[model samples]
Target: MKSKKKTLNDFGGIMYSTDPSFVYEDKNSSPVEALANNQQDLRVMLDKKNRGGKAVTLVTGFIGTDDELDKLGKMLKTKCGVGGAAKDGEIMIQGDFRDKVLLLLQKEGYKVKKSGG
Candidate 1:
């Protein structure tokens, strides 16, 4: 069985357009270019909310394509030897590895900042 991918309903439930000049545009058609590592501003934070009391290190503020984000996430996970996820411009590390992640990102030339307490 093939899985269906979900997409935005940009038509707003409109069935037809009377105007001949009306053209449907896909806002997400263009992919966002990935920024340089040094130009990327990233934040590493430890979050415990909505996941019981277990803390997870979240890396946010990544301005890049999904593939680049996934690669970075995979590298972090492999280096730290932990499981996590990366999506919607955010990377979630399974544990409180803020210091480690910060250093790793710095070595990778990313401008990283530690956020939250």
Candidate 2:
């Protein structure tokens, strides 16, 4: 008796048989390139508002999604050891962390620009 061999097509096509690691690597292979491709104007500003009677550093830009902003805000908060939030598609850190945030954003391959005094 002969047995039949299972091929990728037998499942759901090439994507199903593709190596998961390779898929991930290929997906994230050109993050910087993607960022550049999606580049838009970014404004890093300092805001002093009546809320809580304290000032906060605000970083606003045209990112793809709120998830990205949340992730960036979380990283900045952890690095700066402060509390922060991502709201209205902007990141708000709890201090004057513009310079640090700028450097961090640059490290993440974003073309950052400082705005305001």
Candidate 3:
């Protein structure tokens, strides 16, 4: 089994059990199926909340496996010619490229929305 950092929520609301015969089943054990490009509803926005006031084009609302997310992130970074990261179901491009990112996602058949100011 692959190990992931555990948080309180991962316990699935079961803190303790007195029963001798008990098992803890991981609900997230099953892999998530990647949604099709057309089925994906993506939001692009300019964010600067935590990066020392530096802006980044943040892409969210991706429903897919990590591999697919990485692939999409890589393509965006390459096309935009910038450094960025894809994690926690969000992509962070190192600069404010909201309009460009929106166009790129639209070209890829994803339902893209421009959000934030």
Model 3 misplaced regions, further than 4 Å: 1-25
Candidate 3: give its CA RMSD in angstroms.
5.1
lDDT for each residue of candidate 1 in 14-40, tens digit (9 for 90 to 100): 667899999877555566788899999
Give the Cα lDDT of each candidate: 0.90, 0.70, 0.91
Clashes in model 3: which pairs?
Answer: none
- Give candidate 1 misplaced runs (Cα > 4 Å): 1-9, 16-24, 27-29
Off by over 4 Å in 2: 1-40
**lDDT accuracy of residue 97 in candidate 2:** 88
Best by lDDT: 3
For model 2 the TM-score comes to 0.63
- How do the predictions measure up, each by TM-score? 0.80, 0.63, 0.80
lDDT at 73, model 2: 83
